[model samples]
Target chain A: MADNEFLGNVGGRTLSKPPTPGDIFFDKSFRFLTRAFTWATIFLLAFIVYKIGGKALPAFPDLGIKFLFTSVWNSSENVYGILPQIWGTIYSSFLALILGGFFGITIAIFITQDFLPYKVEFALKNIIELLAAIPSVVYGLWGIYVLVPLIRPLANFLHEYLGWIPFFSTRLSGLGLLPAVLVLSIMILPTVAAISQDAFKAIPHKTKEAAFGMGTTRWEAILRVMLPTASGGIFGALVLGFGRALGETMALAMLVGSMSTLTLSFFAPADTIAALLANTFPEANVGLETGALMYAACVLLLITLIVNIAGAVIVTKATPGGDRR
Target chain B: MSQTGLQLPQLERQPMEPRALKSIILSAITIACAITACIPLFSVLILLIYRGGKRLTLELFYTLPPGAFDAHGVGGFGNAILGTAFMVGIAGLISIPFGILAAVYLAELDPHSKISETARFCAKTMTGLPSIIAGVFAYAVVVLVMGHYSSWAGGIALSLLMIPTVMLTAEEAIKMVPNPMREAAYGMGCTPAQSLVKVILPVAMPGIITGVVLAVARAAGETAPLLFTALFSESWLSPNNPTASLAVLIYNWSSSPYENLIELAWAASLILVVLVFVLNIISRSMGGKTKL
Candidate 1:
């Protein structure tokens, strides 16, 4: 064969060569295109803050810091205060965090600690995840139709006998903090359980074996060793769950009764910032009221950002390699 | 001392010790807590089927929703369904390509770049963003700018909520593509673009599809983002006009004083749940099969 032909035929193909101009051009453009898209994603976050903050600027000067401390929200008179909503948001989410955190951690322990057969554990995990698949609006529907009525008797009893306590001072009135908290807890359950389960699963097998070898009972080992080992992750899960509860809108709107009042009574109507935004934004007039609602949204966004970012940081740090994905 | 010259302890069978008993009780408590966590799921499912299932007729898929004061359960949510499909489809179109390309950048082109790290962190943070804030965003950027609520605004809102989910999941899928596959492609003298388009994409298709389906499902059920962006309409949907959605329809009707409207809300809830659950199952099954 000729020298040129032999060169082309080496290794059954043409010899290696630098990328052609077209190849280089296409590759460079492809990289640029992908990079552009990535930047777009980051820009989206900034855009949200800019647009929301810009709209809320007018209200900030008008309402001042008092917007967060005053409770009355008279939209018709163009006066807006979100203190009650803020209080409800924090109070309901805190209660939900406690309820959801407890059950979620326990469920995670049960599933990860060989408490059940493999198939059952897998099925249970999926079932719990399915709770998250249900829409918030449907949860609202269920809350209104089923949960409220179901809890009414207990609420009545609490009011009837324990009415002296401020928490049960008022009637259930078909919508209140109690039902909202209950639904919110249920809503955050999947987040907490799923994250905590991963946390428990990430515990080193040797750690578990060491506990067993030390003659610790299963529960003792789990409580004394595994829980501490996964404490960071579990805490992260609770924080994330709390973040989710704080932002929950439709269900809380439907169940919390949309009343802007600060009270200790769990049976009394209450409002959350998210629910307030969802309820008011539609009917809010063109200028100041809309700005106020936007301001409330800004507040809600700030809170959730702080909470979710903290939670994400904790989760990342807790994972073994400091990278969850 | 025993015959073996070791101090052999007594081997008498003993009742359960306090620690063992405590362990058993705690284990039982864990089981109880698991069951308690599951109660809400079963309750919601059973109640949904019991109440919502009763209203699931064939007409529910093709009829317009009942009027606000309609005494009879005379209409369906067909328009809302179409509107939801339109908005979610628009959101999918907008988010999917952008998300995948971003994922490509993060996972393939510049895996360790600072920009990639920032983008990844932003995406993680965005996943927890309040859906309602996305509505406010759309309201400001799309609705206020356009001077009207439009399906486009709703789509924009949903797309915001969906992009993070898609990007994160797609990045994960791309990362799961083994290193040797890329090496093989490179060894074949293929350019980076060619390799990604022809080899990496095909391998990651299943995972990408699963992510897209999951994102779409989530977008479909979101009510807060659509509440103001779409701003429910009684008429049929158009891109420029405020459009109805099943979620908003349920929200509006669930509280209606009219019994029939309430029933229609239940039916809508049922349909939404089924749609979300079906998509979830599809993604789960596809995900199971795509395990590398």
Candidate 2:
């Protein structure tokens, strides 16, 4: 009460005094820095759009919609098509999502259940987070040195054994769609696993207890009860993982062979939008080349926007309101 | 199996024979996964020490990378390290204040406003945007518009990447400052900025520093954004020049066909990883100090 008395006097001296016209005007003048900074951030976005738009407009009139559909990326003749890059980005990211979803969810389940010791679970979770800490370039180097050699024979074996399959037909090049996909899988697994782990841990223990009370086995209880309860969270995790995979650059750049051609075989040459952007943005001379690169970035940005929106929607739907501990 | 007189759930709820075995098996696999995660981190560290350890005298830190690769000779990554320090330093300078201020605005002043909400959304989206895209943005705006890629362009890109992290962490730290503290400051006639810089910032200083340190560490190890904006140099090193960082150097060398170059790349990677690891540990140590 004493402190409030003192504070009341101070606040009254500052704010409750009959508003002097000069004091109010002076305060308004002091807001210049804040407003300036706010506008500066706004200007950054505007400038970015203008720079990208100025270059992109030239190609828009002539290329129309045909440019995106065509696969040819011939530079000498000045024809650039983004179909392969777009397709590669989608294909590799999808592959990452599928592989990471399966393994990450399984691991999350293993950790959440009474499958591992407490210390082991703790250590495994830290390990996954550590994987997230390592820079993407380091992952690329590791992938090239270890993962490629390690997976080459496996890829080759798959090619030889399952040559009839469309995706497994090409000879192992050690650096192509397969390597890119595998690297992306590894990169995204930790993301998915982390999110899924949180989801699984959030499930109420009473639900599993009730399932067990019904004479269900541990696996049966998890499959029938826990999985259904956490499916929304799992979906959110997948979307987040998908976002990470789509935006990944250095690692994918190193693994994706980087030839701008669309092909069916996973072992064939491929290029992702991010990889192409990273590769060409520095070297692009001017005008259309630069514009095309920005177009590629716009596509990358769109993919991320879609991923975030989808994840947000799923997460919002999954969470029930007014449920608190 | 149900009639085998082995009622597992009814009896101690443990499968005596299989439970122990399954636990052991799961424990082993978990351990293996942890070990797998550590392999690359440890390998990079060991590689750096093995290669750089032999020439770890004072001169190694004092000289630049020699033109030719000499296996047994001593040369340094002094320029690359300095370049990295400058780039990260400039980025930190540009980003830290703005980031912390924005975070303050979001967490404290007019937090529910449409502007704050939009800012928060952009900050979050920026957090997840590819580092390469930031580089692309910088290239388009700072470099291409200016008609040349410069260190400023690289620094700006890195700053963009660093902002979202700082903003998120700072907001979190400031939000933890107990509302009564802010209320008290306001009661004493301190302006919002004053309250932030004095009361809230002091209380949140350790967390903000920790966030800043982690952000610097990430910026230090970033290779993708630097590749285009900060182009590499062999002998001539200038902060004004579009210069390369240790991480990008490592990337280039590791991918090259030359055997000795690959070793140098590994050496650089080793150093970079250790630097980041040390920074990470420092942040973790600071993060462990406070409880939410």
Candidate 3:
């Protein structure tokens, strides 16, 4: 066909020739295939919610909304409650967030502030990320053999000397909230640090320069100006870290002692919803007990969904260039 | 002369200002925090090596796990190793194609369409879905429906976790392809599909592979999603039977009363860690090459 020959003209452009039937068919199928894949991906989230929610529905008639508030969880008695697990999940995650968040932000500042050589910074970043690559089960194993024993003396000392305080009231047991919180903090450090590092990096260079130009010290700029500007992203990081900690199962199941209790003492044994699900699900009977466990899973899913959506929103909004990825 | 003489006595270097002291102290604190954050990593690694390394043996790679009361050197988690590989491979098969295709739609076919935007949001949200929930979902959708536990269900659970990660990363990689290349392909009278396959996908292959490797690494390490889905087995890999995996073996054995089982758990932990680390390093290197 001639270059200017056209079977159809659209948008004032001459066509060499119309697409062949085979080409047209292939193009339509290709587009349809990709669109189907995209929809399938989107449909997956909805399907998960539906399946889990439907499975959990039977529990509402038996346990009622009181399931969220009642603490006792005796399988033989047919009365199940996730109150303690819920409390433990929130409490340990909150404490982990505080410890992880502080150190994470500090590490972020340390790496992003040009304090270290570029090569050193790059190596440090990679090392921090390596923490994430280690399996949770391995952390649990190490916690049992190494961390719990290592922290026992300190925990006992705090209990002995400062026993009046609620946080340090209980003596250090073999597996308790303290080790779980510590390990959880370590597990979440990478997420918090990596996100906050991006947040700090997203700040306009002039902002830092302007602070320095105003005769401010490095600390002054970082503490007063940079932190305020990146607070949204940092908050988002903490939220996401909290979500991760809440969902963490294997490590907490091994380390938290799986004792269903509500206590302020960090040394007391506690259970989380995720840990409870993991420890109990395999052996649970296919009735009220299983339904209750599914109910708990539903609750956990709801919490994580809310937290992650909020964090994602905050992060996307706070990012300066608007979705660099 | 008088003014110079009066100022000369006061010109000695003053003591360090409090502001300078505070800055130095804060800097020290941040450096300290960074060091503190690293302590756990070193501790975990050292303990894994010191404890897990002792249990490492050539026999550990090929034997089945010892019975609970069996002697120390009787068995290994060879079944779990194979199971992990088989299930993770299944997950890769399901998610890699779906993720890359969805990415192509988002980054190439209609970058700013409403459906693309919604799909992107859904992928991001799915990234935060708890692995346990994914297991439950699989249990409901696959196990309850099929009336049995299988590696297929486990892979489905893992694919649920893997899809978002692969999709997001693949999308980023595809978008990173230079715009001029696309224009050049079209300028050469290439159709959209042809340009995508020939020009865009070739350039984006490394980044996509990096995502795949990372997703696979993550899937291999996951225990929660496989707990109820794959369950656990003592036997070798079977499509219908429950399967063992390194992560679950570590979880199950770490708590056993037997000293030998504990030792096996440590060894499995070491191997799992090394496997995940290698995958991560591979992905990191590939990612560096692609600069995505």
Best by DockQ: 1
Best by TM-score: 1
Query: Candidate 2 at B276: error in angstroms?
Result: 1.4
TM-score of each: 0.96, 0.86, 0.95
Worst 10 residues of 2 chain A by lDDT: A316-325
On lDDT, the candidate that comes out on top is 1
Winner by DockQ between candidate 2 and candidate 1: 1
Q: Give one digit per residue, the lDDT tens place, for model 2 in B77-151.
A: 666777778889989998897788777777777677777766766665666777787787777677767777677
Cα RMSD over interface residues, candidate 3: 1.1
Error of 3 at A131 (Å): 0.5
Q: Which docking class does model 3 fall in?
A: medium
* Arranged by TM-score, best first: 1, 3, 2
Please give, for residues B166-189, the per-residue lDDT of candidate 3 as tens digits: 999999899999999999988887
Tens-digit per-residue lDDT, B156-217, candidate 1: 99999999999999998998888899999999999889899989988998899999999999
Candidates 1 onward: DockQ, in order: 0.83, 0.34, 0.76
lDDT of 2 at A165: 97
Worst 10 residues of 1 chain A by lDDT: A6-15
